[model samples]
Target chain A: MIGRQSILEADVDTTGINSLRNGPDDNGRFGIFGGRFVAETLMPLILDLEAHYRAAQKDPAFKAELNDLSVHYAGRPSPLYFAERLTKHLGGAQVWFKREELNHTGSHKINNCLGQILLAKRMGKTRVIAETGAGQHGVATATVCAKFELPCTIFMGATDVERQMPNVLRMKMLGAEVRPVTAGAGTLKDAMNEALRDWVTNVDSTYYLIGTAAGPHPYPEMVRDFQSVIGSEIKSQFAEAQGKLPDAVVACVGGGSNAIGTFHAFLDDADVKLYGAEAGGHGVDVENGHAASMTGGRPGVLHGNRTYLLQDKDGQILEGHSISAGLDYPGVGPEHAFLHDSKRVTYAPITDDEALEAFQLCTRLEGIIPALESAHGLAQLMKVAPTMGKDQSIVLCLSGRGDKDVESVGKYLGLL
Target chain B: MTTRIDTRFAALKAEGRPALVTYVMAGDPDLATGQAILEALPQAGADIIELGMPFSDPMADGVAIQLAGQRSLAAGQTLRGVLGMVEDFRRKDETTPIVLMGYYNPVYSFGVEAFVKAAKAAGADGLIIVDLPPEEDEELCLPAMAAGLNFIRLTTPTTDDKRLPAVLKNSSGFVYYVSMTGVTGAVIKSRGAVGEAVDRIKSHTNLPVAVGFGIKTAEDAAEIGKHADGIVVGSVLVDAVARSLKDGKATDQTVGAVRDLVAEIFSGVKRARG
Candidate 1:
């Protein structure tokens, strides 16, 4: 068992990224995952972004404006609710839920989109482009862009477009163009490729809003910084509520934005346990189910930076399966890679069956309906909570509400 | 007929100079221009030519290389088309080694045995599939080697001592040491770190060590060449071809840029060796 003390002392930079506005060049990536991965034709635009992002981060007005919007519009300082019923049922650890579900468009994704769209407006970029799976990000991006009166284009997997029709319609209602990408397995990965192509084509006057904390360089770091609000809030709230940090911090990992965001402020805290729950679809078979890249994958370079991915012997990306649409990704954020390798955090997988059971338990016991993606974290709490005493605290990020998943869940239960 | 990669290394060893490998995207702009680029590499001091067999999705490649794949794929460049270009290059220049490089899906789609046989028949000397790590070497590496092809393996900065032996075990061609921890085309301020990495790999294997990924300028090549047996320049060469196509003339201008870059790096290598 590698101790947290040894993990914290490792050479890798665990300092939360300093600013939000800096682009690819500034942080050596985009949002921690984005970098200059395109042709020279796009370099000028990327450089322009780097310069503008740096300026915006330093400008007090931009910071105040973003902060104000987070509070007033998007609703900042989302509550950390103690799940008394759940804790009583578990008979061990006292579990608390960070309600990101109560945010404007729902989910922790709004944190990144709000920050990036603000940066985009400051950069004088009139159009925003985004890629999404399950449509949570697309809906969030479209809603923000609509609020700002910026033209928005969203690239979604054709399969996702069909499955998550409500999100696609929501984007359209927001006057955003939803481009269905039909290439390469028609999933989140393909949507990303198409979005990247769009960004290259429309680099000028366009800001690409990456959804998750994954991609290349700056994106992973940048998105983590933006989403770090979750962690910062958790730290303060936990201190106020319990007089000490929770014993464990748990969140679902898709591209790992929510997990990374929620885990960032606690990385330096040696005593706090951090867990990232990956989607373990039906089973452990790579082809059949799950987006448990960290648990099931090898370290390989994908999208940009080296991260865990569901790839074959030859590096061809396998189409990852998950019951939750948001968790159906093959790769994860690079910072998560750094964290996993350094043993700063424990990454485990929750099977779809387990997540479903957890979802039902949360709804029936706590009277809270969670997004299928967020249910994975609740599933982890179920596993880990029973071992610890009732006094021990656990913080789980309830990423989004289950309203969007009602139809899917009903169909799964054979009630629709 | 059977020229071992070791024989080439031994011959180069007597000369006391590092080999210069140039990578070009096949059918970039067009197939004719790709052939011209291939024809021009050796004259420009490129001892080895790595022809990128463009695929629909190249996961390891950055934007420049990804676009190059897109362009090649758009121009209807297939594995067969790339092999034809290799065949054409072999007609005029037989001394320079030509390695087919790309992802494995296209090759797998083409049937491994048939692809190996066809690649050998088409005059390709080596294979460097970016995705094919040493852990799963039996899939294509063994079959390719069985068909008289040299299977080149890439060792990254993260590949520790425990993994090096297995990586070098069946590796017949020169080992490609990725210069950094990240993806390809990332810039490095200096090759000092890469030179150290080269030294570490050299301690493990007798195979020729080629340093690549982020070796942009001639100075970088020269600095890396001091410790490495070869230096591979990829993105910059691809950029040059892309630059040439910006003008209506995709002829000697593209080839000329690559030739000039190669000459600059070759001079640095000479100076370093001397």
Candidate 2:
């Protein structure tokens, strides 16, 4: 078991966002690593976003509307609770949980989906297309598009469609078309492929609501910027709670949206520790199940931008496995690539067994069941919290509630 | 004659006609048929031959080329296998320059040093990695040059003056000017823009510049040939192979279609030269 004392004693710096704003394209892509790599058909739409996002950041009307929505609809200022019981039980450092679960849709995914859907409306796009695994992103997309009266198509892998039937139905009820993509491995990556094909076929009328901070240029940067609210909120929330930022910020990385969102605000904060928890299925071996791209992959181009990927000797993409459907992808976001290369963040992996153990522990101790994807981050709390004294603080982003994962957990526990 | 690519441009300039380049995916339909198409290209008025090494995912390519890649991969075509084809061709013909074209991952997987050495040893005169640009030169360009193999650079409409010089610096054999702003197999109605793009690139480098991406028909090739040093057609030929397969006569149809396009393009080049 990992200790928590080390996490609290870690330093917290908050200068990453300031540097990002000052960098190229007002986001941090050094060169070929970052740019908008959308098709020519969507160039005008993205350009509109480039203009609106710049304006919205400065516009009081936009800020006020977003603030109002966050407060009333999505439940703004999510609590920062000290995990005293967890810390004491683990016999380690102090731990604090940044409760993103309290948000309306019960996950950090809503933060991005809601923001992008609104941007889509502003851009005069009436239809939205999204890809999902575990149906978290699809549900979120369906939820937001419903609220906005925008038509949506959610592409889910046939495998995920079978596993996440409840969320699939929820998306259907929310009035979004649930497209079960049967190609490839019938997983998140396949869903993304189908979504891209749809976007290419319907580029004129549909807005591709990319679920994470991955894909080609502009998307990784754009999605990160939209999701950066998590980091920005955490900075002030942690400050108010502990009279300073937490020593470390830890979040799970699937396609890395949630991690990047939570990590971006602290990039330049040289003192603050940043940890990206990757899905370690069984182990790090190629054939062994794991989505530890940063740990196991080489620098290669995939999707749009050059990033790490699980590929064979011939550079053919290898299937990635993880208990969490969301984290079972071979490639990671490009910014994570930049961060890994620049040594700005530490990327590590948590095994499926470890995450499941953490999932059960958190549910038993706190009466809060976390999505398996978010459990990866909670698992890190056990690893990092035990090394420091009680004075140091560790903040773990609880990205989603686990209600959607009850059936899977039941089966895993042999209670189904 | 000078060893520099510019000297080849000078030679083509005295002829006062554009070079007619032909592109065919290696192992498309089957290895034997793809090889046969390659061998027959020079006789069909092809000045430079661009042979594609298939990849599973070709982001820059259209459906026609993508299908060709699928067929090639299904036939178990490897980079080594394609290089072997080049060796076989070199035994009989060596005057016409052969450029191996494909995505970067295969080469990266093959190990840059090993791939460069193998390509040079196999009698491959040049390489055209569609996805690799100046940004990724460290991966293959430097090693390829060290092995005495030409690294052809692709300059798209997006390649501005600011970025052109870097593209030209690392480039060898020739510069492949993508005629359109989209993927391969797209058709452009106007050649005026392509001519202007060729002129823009000419102002930057004196290398033999071949224009491709949307050159579908002979007229399109001829129009582009007026401005470019070489007119390259890809999708039209791949489409021919696809048509052949659909017709259940891929062997005869693919070769015959390529022959027809080559004759038309050659006639255009001859008219320009005269």
Candidate 3:
């Protein structure tokens, strides 16, 4: 039981406006969690990249270019559809899905990719690179690179490359090179290491399009700004659909880009609750079996930012296990850590078996196959929505499509 | 509290020759073999010793050093055992500077303040924390400096004029100029460009500058010695240790082969003008 202040009472912006969204401060600290913890070799480039991002944030032309691509290329303003069958089945809260799974490249990842690819072009970078776990982010990046006519590379763990081979083929088909990282358990963390190595080596020509809302400063900040469009759209869409904000907003937390996007706009609304569901693999009670950073890990720095990390007493990061590859990361974003500490956001662990159950249930109930990453959020919704009144409404961020995860789920359930 | 790093650099300046800095992963192949290599380093003509604290995931490392660390970990080399190697080496040769080079996680997990105290007590001269940058000086760099241990900073090609001062601010004893942008082990091919970068760094700091990354042969060391105050060798030495092993155990020639290579590299530094 990690105790935190009741954010419902604390840090309330009385003006019905968001102050949490305006964070982090100039040093990129969301309450001492996010900061640039890189090597001296990469510091200048990071600083330079930060400067470019800051200037781009103010330039209307940059905004125009990115906004244009988001609408026409990636299909912006993904719909807010009321899940009638799901609501009826839950028999408690009214359910609506801010359908990010409908977006191009089949997830909310393209929202960030389009924003970053525009920035890369403005910076005159010729090549782009990124790391992926489930291959959603890699495909998004590869798609944007193909459209922008820039060469692209994606670093994926050897294990992921084999399991998510279809997405690997998708990236190669989209004219991007896919490199398999064979380090540390062959997962997301190892791929991130290889990507950073590539970024250091090719700093002059390559712009690293980080897929998550974690990493060194400017990244966590900027990626949030990019993905904030999700929340920004929901604010208006929910008002049009429900005539007001939903009672609660729920999203799955991996590296926490989608969750941040879902919760960023409603941060100032004290009436609306926010929930984040993290992967609890076998169980967090066992040593190194899960990815529930907030509930099961301690604060430490990794891959640039200080956040809750699943590491050993020796400070070595323990590899996270999840039936969903996208959520199989040992660390969460720094802002999520701040929210967890402040109690503005409630975080819970969703076990693999529970998520699998929700994955099947959502498909049958709503006729929508959800990505296993989003199934964690659905699992949490299944647990909590039944406890709420029928008049209350909850919005679940259906973060990605299930196509990339179908084979893995098939193998897991012995359906293959 | 004068650090051995400062003393060695000063002595090398007086000698008008570049210092030979050797890096070998502690507990590589096994603890006993790693200890033998450490004991033989100074006698093999190495002026400064860099003992790599073996880590499970060395992000900044290349294949050679990565394999060496794995070898050490497979032999059950914990952070304490690696530090003990430094303490054991101090018992015999206290003059040769020993810098513990590795990532920040092990020390962070060990607790920064406690790690610094133990490192100082163990006779470790300095640190080259690859992960913590100038922005995170509060994390480990400043504390290590206050404990009478030198915090050496690594400068690279991308470290521009604007960033050089910050990199050099808390840096003492020596500045490490990484010869390339990539991970360690990939050799620096452009000798002239590296020489100019070393000279550029010398213009900013009075502290000696040691150059590393890709100086594999004696010729490579002598050429880099023309520009640097110290020549640091890591990956090749680690690779030597890896190749000398048979079935994961150190063969009879493991320690001797590394010592012979270090002597040859040292002779190259000796041949170069100060």
Q: Where is model 2 more than 4 Å wrong at Cα?
A: A1-52, A121-127, A178-183, A193-206, A268-271, A286-288, A342-344, A388-392, A411-416, B1-23, B27-37, B40-48, B62-84, B107-274
Interface RMSD of each candidate, angstroms, one decimal = 10.9, 5.1, 1.2
* Tens-digit per-residue lDDT, A125-211, candidate 3: 999999999899999999999998999999999988988888999999999999999888888999998999888888799999999
Q: Clash pairs of candidate 3?
A: B187-B214
TM-score of 1: 0.64
| Candidate 1 global lDDT | 0.78
Full candidate order by lDDT, most accurate first: 3, 1, 2
- The candidate scoring highest on DockQ is 3
Clashes per candidate (backbone, < 3 Å):
24, 26, 1
Model 3 residue runs over 4 Å out of place are: A1-18
TM-score per prediction, in order, is 0.64, 0.76, 0.96
Q: Which ten residues in a row have the lowest lDDT in candidate 1 chain A?
A: A1-10
Q: Chain B TM-score of model 3, please?
A: 0.98
lDDT of 3 at A202: 84
The digit string of per-residue lDDT tens for model 3 on B90-162 reads 8998699899998887788799999999999998989999988888899899999999899999999999887
lDDT per residue for candidate 2 within A1-416, as digits (tens), equals 11101111122332243364323344325443554433333344455556765555555565566667777888876888887788788786677788888888788788777667766876688799999988888988999999999899998989888877788889999999999977557788778866766665554578889888887545776677667778877888888777787788889998999898888778778888888899988988648378888888876666655678887667766668888888988888887877888788888889989999999999988888998998999887778877766777778889888888889878988998
